[model samples]
Target: MSRPVSTYRVQLTPDFGFAEVAKIAPYLRDLGVSHVYLSPVLQAVPGSLHGYDVVDHSRIRQEFGGAQGFREMAGVLAAHDLAVVVDIVPNHMNTANAQFLSVLEEGAASPYADWFDIEWREGKVIVHRFADDLPQSEHYTVVDWREGPGYRRFFDVSSLIGLRVEDPAVFFATHEVIFWLLDEGLVEGLRIDHPDGLADPRRYLDMLRDRSGGVWTVVEKILIGDERLPDDWACDGTTGYDVLNRVNGLFVDPEGRQPLVALFTAMTGQDADYHAVMARSKRDVIDLFFRSEVERLARVAGASVQDLVDLLVEMPVYRAYVTPGEPVDPVARRIVESAAPNPEIARAVLYGSPEAVVRFQQTCGPVMAKGVEDTALYRWYPLACLNEVGGEPDRFGLSVEDFHDFCAGMRPFTMTTLSTHDTKRSEDVRARLQVLSELPGEWAEAVRGWSRQVSFDPHLDYLAWQTLMAAWPISAERFTDYLLKAAREAKTATSWIAQDHAYEEGLRAFAAKAVELPIGDFTALVDRHAVANSLGQKLVQLMMPGVPDVYQGNERTDFSLVDPDNRRPVSFPCAPNSAWDEAKLQVTTQALRLRRRLGPDAPYEPMAAEGEAAEHAIAFGRGRAVAVATRLPVRLAARGGWGATSLTLPHGSWRDLLTGGLYSGRTPLAHLLSRHPVALLERHDL
Candidate 1:
């Protein structure tokens, strides 16, 4: 199995395809990444911006230069000594898929009938096309759009139908192209998308491992707090939301929990408890979007629909990892019993019904995604940065001891990332937002003033204020799009399904006014500290015990927000336009190059600081390389700035990779970080 020393994520779209990737091969090599990680490369829905909605499994996307172009691109990357890691979406595919279309056209008689997870009744399939005038098919019936589809869909998205990958025939058919690429050595590794949606994630992974010769792979599994990946799964590890949340938590100030919560609750008139908000959001989604999934689970479990809904809403983690026909893992059993509405249901799920168990496990992921990440995160954000995917907003900060513990246990080959196309905000934006935790009073004042100038809906105004400050100097158009998306996702005044035009107009108008408001001074104030947090977190993430991934253009600074916003085209051969940009670029390049040199086998050793400000510093040694970063810069500055704080190096002359400064023995924190808030030091003797 091959593992990358580090990876650089590139979002491949029609505009930026294989040729574009080929053009960047030399640059990516120079950027010091062992692999170039790409988004989904298979054929997808037409004009798709992000290609997760794959339509064909047999061919490369023509819009992205097809098979020949991909071959050329791979060759170019190989010339540059850069391996490839392709993201494969095995959980679902676009409804436009030929196999799915065949099933629709021919129904039960189609050769691909078993390829999808469709419900059959009396040899006829029932589908909800969201239209009254359904297309006439002899073996299928179209019902109300709100009704459950005949087939399992991806997270309420009707267009992306689920794949029954647990079937041996379906698995082989869908993975043929991927296996061919793997055998040809065009792709060295794999990133499996949404393994939770599969009927049996562990079984699917075992098959994947056996077939692919156990090449390096990581699943895009979102692990909640203290939820470890199952030991049976045959992947390297998760795609690193666990690491992301921990690292992000290091910068948050725990002291800000109360004041921030108070301010948010007062302004929004909502409950201060994040879990309560989350539960309400879960129930709302169950009532609105996930009714189909709930109904199906209830039918399979032979339980009441309401009981299943209640249990799903109470589920703390994405899934319990329950495997049928085997003794339930104690941890998984505990999770289900705790979340189940009653003991009988828990027994039914854990011991009795295999169909019920599988359906329940599969449904948990979509419900959590829609309810928590999409809805609750948008609704009850005391500190917007903590509302990230797999993040708990109420859990404010992580102690240095805890973060070190997490890193100590991390699988070294698992990918760690800061920003991605799916991130709610860029790393830099979150860095900016983290500043609020240290200065809640000022942030509240700023929001109050902004609200007086232009207020939209109370439910969304606080988020808008935070967005404006974090993504400062944002264009009105971009901000409006984000705000609109936030509102709809929140499902408060307006939503994607039931658009309230009048409220939407108010939102747009408020966004326009918010952009024009005098918020630059406050943003500048936060940015002064944000620069420190940004550099510190970037350095820590890069040097941590995992394959760090630098999302495109994030090596410098990017304040993009959410999907289409985060997925904008990135320009290469770019130069730093600001001092902050220069510092971040230097930090990114130096750390990446150092990690590349150290390789993946370096051991991590935590280094403690000595003095009154010791808690503000996070230092770690990875063999000959050492990383030191400042956490909670606002509070650090307030406490008289690293006075008397010092770190004992490993008895060798060291050179600061960022500043090229020399150090030896015990180094004072003030002198070590005089030039920049973060330092990447390599032993000079080495």
Candidate 2:
């Protein structure tokens, strides 16, 4: 039997649909991808690019080639020895059109009321008044009844209502679609999206897996820094960002830590305690975006509006581990107090005092990253800088042993992701961002000078770009619209957004000029800024091991900032075609080929060797295949690299595939690796 299909994403609704999929299947197959991952195929709000907003769970969307087309696509994939992995949104469904509107119109009396999670009292529909920033009272309406013909109440999103998966009836009703697909063998795996938003994640996962005959299941879970997924769930590893951070973080310059912190401080004066910084940022965001909902909630609670305020502000952040009905024990005030080294400081700036922290601990002891209030915040802060607080490459605020423990537990199932639907930027986009992090005082000066030359506000432009680029890290599809918004809101030419095409052109030129100098020269001028981005990308891809993932169209280059820009489709012209980009193809093909030749199941032992320029180069071996790469090309290996500059094979000769050089047991490795960015050698025992 063929191996399971894996490493894919969904593309929905085009004149193309499955037929279009057939066209790309060959390209994907060549990349060693097993499955053609798909977005939801269930009936959804018309013209939905991502099928998250399903309208009817039972039927295939008529616009996406429906059931017949879906079946045909599966057949084509099977013929190519590939499987289908369809994304399923069990948390909520879309209420965007007439069908859902009718459900709301019918109120609680509708027969399908129990099909949702309804909290109804009397005839009033109690929709959550989301935030204080929106003009809901004057612009939108709410009712007391929680259930309607097609609509139901979810946490805060009435437009995208929730389903009570905990309810057996609801589970059964929703599983109808799942059952049909699995029974027919239409899909072999399921990618559960937004699992953090669900009430009972483990239970839902177990049920879905068990019901599907142990079908391959991966979830859309976001695990920060050291958080691990529940081991109890029967599933394969996550969609793969957990590993992304480790690999990415390894190449970061430890020396740049203090400087980057200082730069942000100079730029954003509000930098205080990291947690406080995050809280203030989030508060501003909520105020700006959710104002109407907050105001409406205040109005509904009447005179006890203070209670409403307290709930939203004082409550611990809700996530996968804290949803209702899960085991929760309020932590004692004493326990919280004892856990903190500085109770007063924790009380002053953190989200909760010792008491509230204890309450959370009592509820979810041994929960993912809840042990450290700061750790949790750093992981969830969403800003890369804030998250980078104490994670230096050679040193860490958290103990390395503890970090390892966390990594071990997390390795089995945690979602290893670089980008998500909620992230500000994509992994590739962020990799480009690291170019700035590596720069010491020098790159900042260059940027300042460049800003002066361009006749633009450098700081403002950088800020705009940061804001704009932030969204690229997320997995959402509406990224381009976000980009356009960034452009419109840019305060300067240097800002992420610009006045026109000319501004974008100028900004690109600046970046191009930024990378023009030699790596050593650049690093000398600004503390390793030159090698930082490339180093960061390589480090993340190779070292911090997990199920490595490559975001769509990011294998070769990533210039996206925020949503609209990042969400642009992979056009044949601009997008890197593995068949065309020789450099990228060389890297990707070599990496994948090495992984295959080593045999995925082979045990790997870490080996260390001294290079002629050890500081500028690192060498390690996987089985008999030794790999070496130079970090800063100017720095040669220190110990003369065995003086021979060639590597010795165990018994037989080794071949350098890229350079077409052959070596025996007496050759010096350094000489062979001299002209290459990277070198790999494999010795077959046979």
Highest lDDT among the candidates is held by which one? Answer: 1
lDDT by residue for model 2 (167-282), tens: 76777777687778888988777778766545567778777777777776777654554445666666776666545555454334455567655654554442435545433433
Tell me the lDDT of model 1 at 437.
94
- Cα lDDT of model 1 by residue, 265-332, tens digit: 99999898888999999999888877877787778788888888888899999999888888888998
Q: How much lDDT does candidate 2 score?
A: 0.48
Instruction: Go through the candidates in order and give the C-alpha RMSD of each one to the true structure.
Output: 1.3, 8.3
Mind sharing the TM-score for model 1?
0.99
Candidate 1 local Cα displacement, residue 683, angstroms: 0.9
Residue 415 in candidate 2, Cα distance off native in Å: 6.1
lDDT of each: 0.90, 0.48
